[model samples]
Target: MPIHEKSLIRKENLVENESLVIDGVDVSGHWSTFITGRSLTDYNDDMQDEIAALPGGENIHRCWQCGSCTNACTVNAVNPEFNPRYWIYLIRLGMEEELLRDKDIIWQCVSCNKCTYACPRDVVPEGVMKATAHWLELKGHTPKSPSTEFDEEFSGQVIKTGKIEESRVIMNFFRRTEQPLAQPWLVALIKGLAFRFPVFYLMRMGMAVVRRPRTRNWAKSRRAINEYVQEVEAANRAAVGAKGGH
Candidate 1:
């Protein structure tokens, strides 16, 4: 028989073939079915360096994008565009611009940690959300964040009065965010005031948040976060040492 000619294949097809053969048969790699694509720069110096600087960011590489993070995320189930898997992949590719452009989605994360609980690899998507949130804040690009207006108005209220007065927070949050306090329910406000309502709705929650008494453990909470960041720094140092590269 004549020797058969080798068929030419695209690089992606070859990678897909290799990936299929490598671990697609395994139970743990089941999510490999969802790989829309993978990038060439899976890991880069700047990405590794950036992770090294962030608290609790050592295991960013541990994420295999199984979608456990996204599936477990409360926000993603409702908002498909708020994807943790894709952002983690972007970080791995040193796509800092893409990540920066995604501040709104990144900051929308409530950090409830359902994703971390679901992640088999302990990737802690919640932690990554916080680190990225801090990163955006440092870049002075947080104005577009969903919670920015509420946070700013709350801070201003606190600074002015050394305390946040409840009703003021509610009104300021609504005005600053340009949120209509009520639409068809405009009559509901008058009803709530007439009835002395027990709780608030939507953007007005800030009012309730400030009126709550400061906790006795408030100082302890602050100290705990400081120590936690230090520990994360230590862990990052160890991770960088083990890798032995920038």
Candidate 2:
């Protein structure tokens, strides 16, 4: 028998004997490979309902496993393990343990919306990816992901100033994630851009970092938005059984 997901198999389950005899015939090497049998009884029957209650997960029930989302997913093209269709199937079936195997990479979705556009059932797989990542964090299955920290940093700036300073957002994100500002790849990219467009690059950086940008008379709008954001956060927490506020 072939396993649909080899990752789900434990290493100890595999048995291999180089020299063996069965029924007076030699059976070794590839033929000697055998997998131990086991049963899963710990299924979270409510997992699907819990995920569906979260934002962006509402349409999960609409999926028919057509696989269009995975076919059009940009991330899936580069990483075969990033299969949105498979994850959706696992979620619908309440295969919580199986889904957790890919938790670390679920947040890697770039929100390109290609999956959503190609989905015949309008599953909005991009949204489901976000929702799943959030669910993982909220349920304490995993710590707050780097993507979540970056999003909070970026959104906080936008909510407060009615705009965002790109440099500030990046710096804040790096700080929260405890990453060095002078990362090799980032430094190289910046150097390349500066070399190609010295004047424009320096001017843009100066504006984004030195002077900064803010909306005029945005205090009132900011207050209103902040209040709304708090309400939404509380509602989400209640739905997921998390604390009322961040």
- lDDT of each residue in 103-144, candidate 1, tens digit only: 677878887999889999998888887666655554455654
lDDT of 1: 0.64
Instruction: Give the C-alpha miss distance for residue 194 in model 2, angstroms.
Output: 5.5
TM-score list, all predictions = 0.52, 0.83
* Most lDDT-accurate candidate: 2
| lDDT, candidates in the order shown | 0.64, 0.87
C-alpha lDDT of residue 63 in model 2: 95
User: How badly does each model clash, as a count of residue pairs?
Assistant: 0, 0
